[model samples]
Target: MDQRPAISASQAGDGVTLAASGNWTVTEAERLNGEIRQAARLPSGTRRVTIDLSGIDRFDTAGAWLIHRTARNMVNDGLEVVYTGIGPSREILIGEVEKSDRPPAEPRREAPFVTALVNDTGEAVIQSGRDLVQLSSLLGSTVLIMAGFLFRPWRMRLTSITYHLEYMGLRAVPIIALISFLIGGIVEQQGAYQLRYFGAEILSIDLAGILVLRELGVLLTSIMIAGRSGSAITAELGSMKMREEIDALRTLALDPVEVLIVPRLIALVIALPLLTFVANMSALAGAGLTAWIYIDVTPQTFLPYLQNAVALNTFLVGLIKAPFMALVIGMIACLEGMQVKGSAESLGRQTTAAVVKAIFMVIVLDGLFAMFFAAIDY
Candidate 1:
């Protein structure tokens, strides 16, 4: 016959003895739990509890847990609890359950508002420090790698550089030109409307020329490259890192920085200046067209005004910043790529971070350059 799970409690002189028996596997856990609960309601004046499990025929973790729980409850009720006649197998099971059963944890005390704020601020400061250190390290390593290539120019990956030049520069020309053209038209329209208030609508050519040449042209191109090519570089390197291809390169005694990063960096340095030049011309073309249509300013007149407004230095200033911005974008992208962990989610996060950081740094660098050039009277 299948013995029903049961627990019986009896009052002693100063304690209660709880006896448990019968099948106590998971199949009988429900009935066993009910009996355990019932046995926990000890008689009055019970100052101690004893559990006798010698009668159990089948015992598993579930059964042992019930027995352990009953004893714990009685102890919580200010009674000393002891187990007697526990069989060898059941004692081992009970021991395992006892190892896991722990008293409820105390509630955590909330920190003061000021304390939390200080802690968060400290963490942010530390994180920023770490990021700066990592970026500096990447820059140093890349410089060293470039030095190595200078000694062995034959080691430079021309094919890879050419591929990236085509991918990031040539293929990107249309969109770059298109966006620049549209922005130029908008600038000229706004400049003409605003300048007409002062009877200087013709100065719109100066406004369009100087702005596009000295700032907007290269700045917007850098931002586009950061968003497009920077993200692509980060995503590509991140995927390779995740798939152990980078590690494989290391095993082959090949430097990943040389094979992967240097070529991309070189390509960016070369491509960005050329792309910036193209964008500047496109933007000027657009502004010229806008001037001719909106204000009836002839291209002949507008060209002369642009030529008079902007000096060689104005164009040179923007072109000079292009390679520097490219270096920043490429380095930041490659840095973020190398930081990626072994997960698709990590790759996506690094790629996003690469784009955001590159754009922000580009703008910051532009502002610094503006200040420096203004100081130097460039």
Candidate 2:
């Protein structure tokens, strides 16, 4: 037999004393139980027990489970089990409850690089062709929509043209100017290096003029308008789609496609060429400034050289590309916007897609123009 603590019963106050401090074992379970049972036998009016596991260092789960059970039993017997200087040394009774509650997640992996590249390229081409067909159809529909205008000549289409032009054209000029100037400076520098090798630096002016006129002038304008105006159009139309406002118009016997999309497409096709002309002029001025600074070539000398940089075909080439790019931007915006699913997040994603797709198409168009120009023996 081993020593068990005795609870001193009293009329006024009664308490139990623990003999040692740290580290007890389940082998000592029966000994602890006898002490606790004795503490419970104290008078109800004077019931309180203090446990001190401050000694006997080193314990295991067996000891902790035993303590828990004793504490429960003491509390049930109207004895207060004050755990003093007691750290939970081996508390492991609630094992599977905690384990089952936390469901483990699967780790994620990226797709293989080659397969990913193939999938992405295929998707982009298919999506581009789809957008092109949609643009052509929208163009035909917009022209056909003018048939409604013959009846009500001052209709919504007319208003939309004015509104979209004001929005996309006038407001977009300053930034377009800045971007063109920077592009001209960069192009002049690139051309200067090559032209300098032959002491033909003055030809950099002609080179800048040709690039700005034939490529960056129209290309930069289209890219800027796509990100700015095209994104806005997509977001606006996507919002309307989300709110079912487009459908509500259909319920009123109105064609949402003609009223909304047609004017925007027409406005873009009409506006981009004028915007490109402005960009071309601005870039040429910037290139001339660069030439003046580096090569000591004055605009009077530069302007005459620039005048013969290309034939009439170069001037007309940008105009042709402009309408196509504008049409691409507008149709892409409207199509993606209309395709937006629920939630504002989808609208934002579609707007981004529209802008990116439009810019990519503008670049591709420029490459085609380069090929076409080269083939023409220019």
Candidate 3:
């Protein structure tokens, strides 16, 4: 009895018969594969094909699969295929292979451009609504926690708040001042260039003073904080979430929000107004220096014009917007951080989202404040 796998094909009355012999296990897989392929190539005009399996002394899944595949190929080529001498055991093995060899379903067609656009827009709107709800919930929770702390001042985390203030405020001042100064100088230069054409270059001081105090100072500071402090906050929170530290706090009966977020929020609210004040003064200094350099307008002449152009209300307006902008940045950063999943990629993505959302909300908030001030003639 040869143990090597073999197959032979013969013709009988307009049909073909395939006889398989020897071992059909994996040891003979290479020979069995060739034999199976040869057996599947039936003679032309053969209307029926039969695979005889009784001669096989040993069989396995590999052998069953080869037999099933040959039979399936013949059937696909429009021949009636039958199996002979396949005992109950081998029959079950072949049947399992057949069951697993189903054709793949057709692919779905892509939607039209307009339909895809509408679907995408709808999804974005839905996601935005969900974000709004989540943010509102967090805001409410934070407010309640703060309210409780008001009555129980001893419960407040002053050290944490002070630590955050040192980082988000005191450390942030130099960069904020540098950027504000450059922006102010640019504004003054451009204003003087335009006003010189109207023989009013001296008025550039007035323009810079009003713009810096009323708008540019707080807006630039907020944008910087959104990119710097807000991203840092998101990354910190996201890392904590990934490490399961947040969950650990929960298990210990501590509110993660009260313990982690309130201190940061309080620090932001306290620090932003001070930063805005620094930004305003820096910008004014830059503007005055640029005015003297570019337009030959000395501080002696620039001061009276600036004083006449911008009142106390102008300075107060930028300060008034700072705390609100700080709250928006802190809330967005914390929310994105809390939403982080358990991965480094999630932390990176959430940090980026926090910065973008905070900047967008800050600008929108500034516009709203502007409109409100105008309506109230403030």
Candidate 4:
């Protein structure tokens, strides 16, 4: 009784028999693997195969699985396979392996292009509606909280509001002024170049004045805030959410929105209008200087043309849009932050989404305001 693994094949009139003997266990896996491979190569005229396991000295799952795999491969190659003399224990082990050895899965088919497009469009529409509902709910809750503050003014977070104002507004002035100044100078140069053909280069001052006051001042400022302050708000709140500080606030019987969101929103509302005013003046100053250098239109001449070109309503229109844009940016930032999951990747994703959505909404809102003003001939 040799205890080493061995396999031998015999052929007789289109039939083959494979006899497996000795220790068919993990200890003999290396030899058993070679023997199993050798057993698979049968005589050319053989049409049927039988695996005789009666001589096996010991058995285990590793050997059973190898034997089952060889048989499976032979069956797949169109040979009839049979097993004989396998005792109850070995048979059970082989049966388990057979059950676990599943065939390869088929590839998936793709949907038609038109069907996929329709499904994507429908999902976007549904998501937009859901976003609208959630934003409205948040607005309502914020309004309620503010209304409560009317009865208890001391509950308002004035210190937080002041801090955010300085952070979002005061610290932002230098970059905003630089950007606005460059834009105004470019606008003036382009206007002067075009108007010079008609010998009306001085009118570039009028163009810069009216455009900045009526549109560019507030629009550019809002976009800047959306990219800068809005993203910061989302990141801050998202970090709090990831650390479970927001949950801790809840446990302390405090409203996270009231403590965290209201102050930021109030600060934005106050800061944006002031920033818009700064942007308008900076743009006007840049335009005037460019006009003087490019067209020799002195400030003395530029001032009168600017006065005649834009009215009080023109300035008020741009200022009026600021607080609304601020509100939109704040709400979108807070909503995206609150949706952050407990992961750094989620925080970064939500922060990017906040800036994108806020800028888009700000532009859309500006368009609506423009349409309203045109309709009323304001």
Q: Which candidate gets the maximum TM-score versus the true structure?
A: 1
lDDT of 4 by residue, 1-378 (tens): 688888889887888999999888898898779878987898787779999999998999888988898889889888999999998889999999988888778887888999999999999999889889989999999999999999999999999999999999999999889999989999999999999899988778878988999899999999999999999999999999999999999999999999999999999999999999999999998999998899888889888889998899999999999999999999999999999999999999999999999999999999999999999999
User: Candidate 3, 70: how far from true, in Å?
Assistant: 6.0
By TM-score, rank the candidates, best first.
1, 3, 4, 2
Q: Over 4 Å off in model 1, which ranges?
A: 1-31, 42-68, 83-122, 240-245, 342-349
- What tens-digit string does per-residue lDDT give for candidate 1 at 198-305? 999998889999999999999999999999999999999999999999999999999998899989999999999999999999999999999999999888888888
Each prediction's whole-model lDDT (CA): 0.91, 0.76, 0.93, 0.93
Candidate 4, residue 209: how far the Cα is off, in Å: 0.8
User: Which runs in model 2 stand beyond 4 Å of their true positions?
Assistant: 1-140, 146-156
Per-residue CA lDDT of candidate 2, range 241-328, in tens? 9999999999999998887888888788888998999898888888888888877878788878888776677677777789988877
For model 3, how does the per-residue alpha-carbon lDDT over 1-378 read when each residue is reduced to its tens digit?
687789999899888889999999887888778867866777778999888998999999889888888887778888999989999999899989889999888899999999999999999999889989999999999999999987999999999999999999999999999999999999999999999889988888888998899899999999999999999999999999999999999999999999999999999999999999999999998999999999887889878878899999999999999999999999999999999999999999999999999999999999999999999998
Can you give the TM-score per candidate against the true fold?
Answer: 0.80, 0.66, 0.78, 0.76
lDDT of 3 at 8: 90
With candidate 4 superimposed using the best TM-score fit, by how many Å does residue 302's alpha carbon deviate from the native?
Answer: 2.0
Write the candidate numbers in order of decreasing lDDT: 4, 3, 1, 2
Residue 194 error, candidate 2, Å: 3.1
lDDT, residue 232, model 2: 92
